[model samples]
Target chain A: MARLPPSSGPASPAPAPVACSPHGRFGPYGGRYVPETLVEPLEELTAAWLAARSDLAFQAELSDLLANYAGRPTPLYFARRWTQQAGGARVYLKREDLLHTGAHKINNCLGQALLARRMGKQRLIAETGAGQHGVATATVAALLGLECVVYMGREDMARQALNVARMRLLGAEVRGVAAGSQTLKDAINEAMRDWVTDCQRSHYLLGSALGPHPYPAMVREFHACIGREARAQILQAEGRLPAEVIACVGGGSNAIGIFSGFLADAGVRLTGVEAGGRGPQLGEHAARFAGGSPGVLQGTFSYILQDAAGQIAATHSVSAGLDYAAIGPEHAALRDEGRAEYVACGDADALAACRFLATTEGIIPALESAHAVAEARRRAPRHGADAAIIVNISGRGDKDMEILSRELGLGGAADSPVD
Target chain B: MPSDSRAHSSSPAATPAAAGFAPFFARARAAGRPALIPYITAGDPTLEASRAIALALAEAGADIIELGIPFSDPVADGPVIQRASERALRQGVTLEHVLALAAEIRRRSPVGLLLFGYVNPFLRLGWGRFAQAAAAAGVQGVLATDLIPEEAAEYRQALAQRGLEPVFLAAPTSPDARLAAIAAASRGFLYAVSRTGVTGAREQVPPGARDLVARIRRHTTLPIALGFGLSTATQVEEVGRFADGAVVGTALVAAVHAAVQRDGPGAAAPAAAKFLRSLRG
Candidate 1:
C-alpha cells in the first residue's frame, strides 16, 4: 500500500460520516450511485421525507389530492367475456386506466410532486418514456402551480405525439434528448444531467421506481393504492385472494405496486411481465430479468440490458413506456429471492392481447398493460377454471391509438385473435 | 502484490489516499503552479490518435493526463464530453482498449496517469480484473464520475489492493459531513467541482469553488483539483492561486473535436498540445 502523504492528517477522518444518503438496499439492489453533486440534495430529500411520512398534515394533504384531484380508489372490474374466451382462469382488471390522465402514473406523480413542494423546491423536472409519466407529472405540476420540465427522447416524442401535446398543453416544457439510442434510457440520462445542474432549485421527479434509493420504495408506496384496493376488492369480488397478480414491468412501478399487497399472501403468486419487443435478442427486447445482468445504470444497481463491455445496450419495445434498459432494484431483489416470478411477452403477443382485450371486454388496454394481459392468457389455462388472475391495466390505450393502428394495419378489430 | 483478499475490509477506518497522489502533486507544487491536467477521451478519433494527443498534452506541461474511458451514457458530462464519448464508442472503444492505450502511453511518458469515466464498465470488467490491469498499465488513479463516497467502500478496497488510488469528487453542494466522508474515502486528489453542473466550459470561474476547497481542507490535506466549466489560461491561473490542480476536460475535448473537424485527424495532437500550453502560459 502507498504511504500516507505528510500534508494529509489522521489515518481516517472521523469515520465515513453516516450522514450521507442511506444504502437503501433490496438484496444488494438499491443504493445512491449518482454524482457527488446530488448527495446533499438526496440527504435533504430523505430527511424531508422522514418528516413528511409522519406528519399528519402532510398525510392529510396528500390523501386529499389523491382523492379529489387525481381520482384515486380506481375500480376493480371483472373481465368475464375476455376470461371465458381465454379459457382457464377468471380475470379481474384493476382499472388504473380510469384514473385522471388515463394512467396509473398520476398516483406517484401527485405523491412526489407534494413531497418536492414540501422540500421547498419550486421547480419539478422529470424524464419520460411513452409520455404517460410526463403527462401525469405535468398534470400534477399544473395542479400544484409548480414549474415543470420533462425530458423525452426525440424518437419517443415522434411516437407518443398525443401525450407530448398533452404535456405541453399542461404548460410544461418538453425537452427533446437525441443522445444515445434516443429512447427512455437516454431521456433519463439527460434528466439526471439537468437535475445535477440545478438540483437545489429543482426536484427530479423520477417517473418510475427504478432510480436510486427512496425512489424505488417511495414510488412503490405512492402507487400502493393499486395493491391495497385490489386486495380488498378481489376478496369481496371472488370471496378470496387472487391465484395470481400480474402487471407490466418497464421500470416495474405498476407491477411492484400491485405486488406489494399480495407479497405477504403466500397463496397469491405475483408475476411481472417484461416487454419482449421482437424476441430474446440483445437489442430486440427490454426484458431485464430475461436477458440482463446486475449493474448500475442511472442511479440504482439492478439488472440492466448492457453489452459484455458494460456499455448500456440498445432496447426496443412496441410500447414506448417499456422501452428501457433496466428494471427496478426491488424487482431484481424479488426475482432473486423467488418471491415474484418474472416473465416476458413479445411485441406481437402484447399487441394481440391489446386487441383481444378491447374486442372482448370493450376496454382498449395500453400496449404496456397488454403485456400483463398476454401473460395472463398464457398462464390462465394452468390456473384452472376456478382460479382468478388480476391484471393491472396500468393505462388506457388512447395514447397508443396511433401505434396500435399503424402496427395492426388500421382495422384491428377484425384481427385473427380478435376474430 | 496483494495476496490477501478483503484484507482492507478488516478496518472500519479507511486509509487516507492522498499518498497515491502525493508525488505527482509535489512536483506541481514545486513548479509553483497548479497541475495542468488535461482530459481526453481515449480513442476519441481512434486509439492511435489518442495516444498521440496524450503524449502531446504531457509534453506541453500536463502534470497528469486523465484518459476518459468512454461510457454509452455519461450523465455527468456536458455535450462536448458526451460527444467525445459517443465518438470514442463509435470507434469500438472499450475499457480494455483504454487500458491498452494507457500501457502504450506509459511506455513513452512518465506523466501521471488517471482513468476517468463512469464505473459500470470497470465493474463490467470485474473490479479485481480492472485493478490488476490498470496498475499493470501504469494508471495511478481512477475517478468514476458517478461513484460518490457514500457507496465506495468495496470499490476502495478493490483499488487499494492493487495500490491504485481511488479518486473521489466533492461537489460545492456537499455538506461538511459529506466532505469529511469523501476525504476519508478518497486516496488521491479530491476533484472539487467548481460548479454544481456537468463538465463543460463556461465564461467565468465559479465564485463558490474556493470556498468549497476551503471546506475540503478541513477534512484532509489531499490536493484539490477544481473541475467543471474551467477554461482559458486566465481562469486556470486564477484557480492555481487556490487549488493544487485545475482539470480541463470539456474544454480540451471540445478543442480536440474542433481541430479534428476543421483540419482532420492529423491536426488533433498538435492542436491539443497548443491548447494545453496556452492554458499553462
Candidate 2:
C-alpha cells in the first residue's frame, strides 16, 4: 500500500522507490528490441533521461514550461449529473481536455522538446494516428523554434484532414504514409525509418508509453503530473482516494499517467478501457488484451494482435486514437500482477456514451475517452451511491466532430458551427 | 564460443564454419580480392524467376547470394527495397516459400546462401523450427535485419545448435564496446553498415565507413562485408581496398525491377548477371 501524506501535514518523505528489472523490463515485457543502428541512440536517450531526472535545473525548466506554456493543473470536475444518471457512484472527471492542444499529449511533447533542445538536436520527428499527438508535437516545435516533421497514415490523414492543416499551419511538414494498413502502425514504421537515417540531427519524439526503454519510462514520468495533481485534488475534495480510477488505453499513455498516481495505493482500483470496435472477431477491434499474444513490435515486447504466422493483424476502432494493435509494456505487467484490470467497449457503446456526455454534461469527450465513459457507465451502477470513481477525460472532441457528424448523419453542419 | 568449438559441437558431418561465407572469404583472400555479394528479393516478379536470378548472379561472380524474405513492414529498408518487398508480398510469398526457393537454389549452385528478412516472420515460425528448417534447406546463414545482438541470445544459440551462422550487423555509430560485442557474437562475416542510413545506393561511400571498418578490424579477425549505399563499381572498388566483401542490394534489386518492366521477368536474370559482372570488375 502507498503511504499518503495528510492534507494538512508537511510533505511526507518520499515513498520507497519502485523496483524494476534491469534494462527496463517490466516483468519480461519491455526491452531494447531495435536494430543495431538504433542501439546507440537508445543508450544516449537513456543516459540523457537519467541525467535529466536528477538535474534540478532541467526539472525546474520543465515545470516552468508546463505551467506557463502548456497549462498545468487542469481542473477536476464533479460530475453530479453523470453520477445521477449512473444511479450509483459519485463520479469525478479529470479535465485534461482543458489543457493546451486539447489533450494530455502536450505534457509529454513539451518534456521531450526540452530534452531535444538540451541534447542540441535541431529537428523533431513524430508519428500520429488521430492527429492529437501530431498537433501537440507541432505546437511544441513551433514554440521551441525547431524544425518538425510528422508522419501520418494516408488513411488517417483522410479521416483527420483538419489536423493535417493544423500541423502545416504550425510550420511542421506533414508526410502521409501509404504502406501496410495505412494507420498508426505504418506511420510508426515510416517515422522510425526517418529517425534511423536522420538521428544525427533529429530527435524522435515518441508520443506514447509503448516503445523501447527510456521512452516508456520517460513519457510516463512526464505525464505523471496528471495523476499526482488528481490524487491531491481528490483527497482535498472527497477527503480520501477514489474507489477506482479509469482511463482509456490505446498505446496507453493517459491510463499509465493516471495509474502511476495510485499504483501503490492498495485501496484504489485501476481499470483500463480498450477500443472493442464492432465486435470480438479478429480484425474487428483493437482490444489487445482480449485477443493479442506476447510479441514484439516497434522495439518493445508487449501483447500484440498477430496472426498465426506472427505477422501483425489489422485492427479497427471508431476512435482513431485507440486503433492500435498493441498496449504498453507496463500495462501488461500490471495486468499480470493483478494490479490493473483491462476491459473493452464496443464502437456503439462508445458513441452512445459520447452523445450522452454531450447532452447530459454539456462536455463533448473525445472518442478515445468515450470508451472510458462507457466503461464507467456500465460499472458505476454496480457500486454503492457513496462510492467514488474518477474517469480521465483525456481530450476534447472538437477534432473528432467531423467523424461523429458523419457517423451520426449530421452532415457538414457539424464542421460549419465548430470553428 | 570460439569458431573451432562451435564447429565441433554441431553435426559431425557438417563443418559449421565451412557451411557459411567463411570459405568464400578464405577463397577471396587466396585470390587477393574482395568477394561480391548480391541481394535479391525472393519472389519479386515470381518465385521461379527469382530462383533463376539468384543462380545467374552466382554464376556471373557473386560469391555469396542473399535472398531477402519479403516482409510487410521493413523499417531498415529504403524505398527501393520497400517497393520490392511490397511487390513480393503481393505475389503471396511467405517465409516457407523463400526457404523452398533456397532449397532449389542450393541444388543447382554451390554459391553460399544467406536468408535475409525481419524478425517477426522467423519468430512466427518459431526460432528452433526456423533454424532447423533453414539448415536442412542448405541455407548458409541468416541475417535478421531488426534483431540486434543484445536480444538475440536465444536466436544465436538456436542457429549455433543447427550449424547455421548467425550474422550480426555493425553500424558506424556503434561504440567500441558494442563493436567488440558484435564481433564476438557474429559468425560467418560482420555486416558493416556503410553509413547511418537505410539500405540504398549513394554516389560516394560515406567517408566514415572506412574508419568504422578500421575500428572493427581491431576487435575481430572475422572478414567484414560493407553494405548499404554501395551502388557504383568505383564505390565497390574503393570498398575492396579496405574490406573483405562488398554487399550490393538496392542497385541489383533496381536492375531486376527495371528488367521486369522492360522485357519481363525472364530478362531480370540476364540484367542482374550483367550488373553483377560490372560490379565485380
Candidate 3:
C-alpha cells in the first residue's frame, strides 16, 4: 500500500550491454554465492561460453538448430479483437507459445545442450516446475542422444501431468522431488545435488535466467531471440516501437529475454507480472517484488520470500510455473534501477484473462502467460487508443488443460476413469 | 537436557582465541597424525541427541566438530547429509536452536567447534547479531558452504570482529588465482574439496585431491583439511600423509542414521562415537 517510486527517466545511453557484470554482479544483486566446489566448474563454464560466443562455427550450428529444429522467428500477431475489447491501446502478442516445445524454454535448452556437447558432457540434468523446461530439455537431449534426467516436484508432476508424460516420452528420466515445498525450488536443489555428485560427466541445463553467475547471463542470451524478433516484427507491423512491453516473471527468463531487446528504449515502459495467488498475505502469493527481501537462494543473490529466520517461505499460485519464491537476479537489478516495474496479477484475474483470450483471440495461453495478459488488459485502457502494447506469450496452455478443466468445473467429460 | 551438572553452568566457557585452530593443528602435528574433524547436523534426531553425539565424538578424539545448521535447501550436501538436514528441520531446528546447542556443547567439550551451513540462515539472523551470538556461544569458527570469498567481505569483517575464524573452501578445480584468494581469506583452515562434487563418502579418494592440496599449499601455510568422500580409515590415513586434517561427515552421519533407524535416538551418540573411533585407527 506504500507509494511506489517514480520511474527514473532513461539514462543518456542504453544500460551497459544487458547483464555485463565483470564479476557477475547486477549492481550488487548477483554473485556466485555457491559452494567452493562449484567455483571452478562455474569459471570453466564462463570461459567456455566466452570462447563459444565468438566462434562462428558454434554460432552457425546453434542458429541452424534454432531455425530448422526449434522454429525461430516465432510470429508476432496483432490481436485486433482483444485490443478492441480492451478499448484502448493496440495489443500485439509475441507468439513464443508456438515454439516446438509449446513454450519459449526450448530456446535456452537447445543452446545449453549444444554447449554441453561441446564440453564433452555425457549426461544432462535439469529441474522444472510446470514441466515446460523439463520437456524442452528432454527434447534437446533426445535429439543430441545424450542421457537426460529431470527433477520435478511431486506436486508439480501431478498438476502438469501432460508435460511429465512428454518429458518421459522424450527419454528423460523424471525424478520426483518431495522435499521442502516440493516445487521448483526443491527440484532445483535436487538437480544441484545431482550436478555436484556428477559434475565431471554431467551438465546442469538450468532452465531459467537465475542461479549462480553465468547462468543468469547465459540463459538470457539464448532467450534474447524472442526480444530481437519481436522488436523487429513490431516495428514492421506498427511502423514504430510499442508504447509498452510486458511478460510474466517466474524465474524471469522470458521477461528478461524480451526486456533485453528494448532496455535502451526509454520511451517504452517495461512491466513484469508476478503471481499474486490470493492477496498480499505471506505464503499466498509468489510476488517476490512485493514481499521478498534481498537474500541468497539456490546460488544467486536475488529477491527471495523468506521468514524472519531466513528460511525460505513456501509460495502458492494457481499456475505452478509462477509458484517460485525467488525471481532472476537481473530482474532484481532492473527493479532496483527503476528500469522495470513489477505488478501482481492474482489467480482470478489470470484465469479470466486466459478465458477471455481463448474466446476473443482464439488463442489459449499458459496460466503463467495469462498473468501478463491480465496486466496488459488492466493497463491498456489507461493508454491512448493508438498506443501499442506487446506481450510475450511465453507458452501454450496444453499442460494446464487438466488443471483448467478442474478449476472451471469442466472435467469428467473427456475420458473414462479406466483410461 | 542431560543431568550433567557441567552443562548447567551459568557462565559458559571462555571464548576461544581468534587463532582457535592453531593449537589443534599443532597438537596433531606433534602427535604425527592428521587432525580428525567430525560433522553432524545440530538437531538430527533431537537437540539433546545432537549434543550427546558432539560430546561423544570429542571424547573419542575428534580434533574439531562441525555442527551443521539444518537448512531447507542445502545444495552442497548429498542425500546422506541432505536427509540429516531434512530430519533436523522436521524437528523444528533453526539457526537460533543451533547457536544454543553450540553453547551447550562448548560447556562440556574442549574440541574446536565450527558452525557450518548455507548463507541465508546466517544472513537472516543478520551478520552482526549472528557473529556476536556465535562468539558468546564459544564457537571457534564458521564455514558457510555457499559463501564464496568474492562475496565474503562483510561476513569476514563480522567474524573477525568477534574473534571467530572464517574458514573458506578450496576446490580441486580452482585456478591459481582463486586458490590464492581462498587461502588469503581463510582463517581457521582451508577446506580442500577432494572432488568436484557435493559432500558424501566415496570408496577411493579422487586422485585430484592430493594435487588440490598441493596447489593450496603454494598459496599459504594454513592447515589444509581434505574432505568430500572420505569415509574409511584408509582414506583418512591417505589424506593424513599430505594434508593437515581429514573431514569425515556423511559417513559418520550415515552411521548415526543407521543406528537411530535400528535402535532409536539413544543410540545416535554411541554409533557416531564408534564410527569416529574406527576412522581414528
lDDT per model, in order?
0.87, 0.87, 0.88
User: Which regions of candidate 1 fall more than 4 Å away from where they truly are?
Assistant: A1-22, A411-419, B1-19
TM-score of chain B taken alone, every candidate: 0.92, 0.93, 0.95
Candidates 1 and 3 compared by lDDT, better number? 3
DockQ of each: 0.70, 0.66, 0.74
Candidate 2, residue B104: lDDT: 82
**All candidates' TM-scores?**
0.93, 0.93, 0.92
User: What digit string (tens of lDDT, one per residue) describes model 3 on residues A11-86?
Assistant: 2122224365877888888788888767777777787777777666777778778877887778888898988777
Candidate 1 residue lDDT tens string, B1-281: 11212121233212222235676677778777888889999999989999999988877878788999999999899999999899999988999999999988877776678999897998899888998888888778999988987778787888999899988999999989889999999887899999888888999999999999999999998899988898899999999999999999888888888999999998899999999989977
Recovery fraction of native interface contacts for candidate 1? 0.90
RMSD of each: 10.0, 4.6, 6.0
**Candidate number with the higher DockQ (2 or 3):** 3
Name the regions of candidate 3 deviating beyond 4 angstroms: A1-18, A414-419, B1-13
True contacts kept of each: 0.90, 0.67, 0.90
Candidate 2 segments exceeding 4 Å error = A1-20, A412-419, B1-18
Q: In candidate 2, what are the lDDT values of residues A1-419, reduced to their tens digit?
A: 12222211112233223334558788988887777888888888877876776676777777777777777777788898988877988898998898899999999998899899888899999999999999999999999999999999999999888999999999999999989888999999999999999888999999999888878877888888888888987887788889999999999999999899899899899999999999998799999999898888888888989877677889999988999998999999999999999999999999899998998899999999999999999888887887888999999999888989878777744546654
Task: Indicate whether candidate 2 or candidate 3 has the larger lDDT.
Answer: 3
Q: How displaced is residue A374 in candidate 1, in Å?
A: 0.7
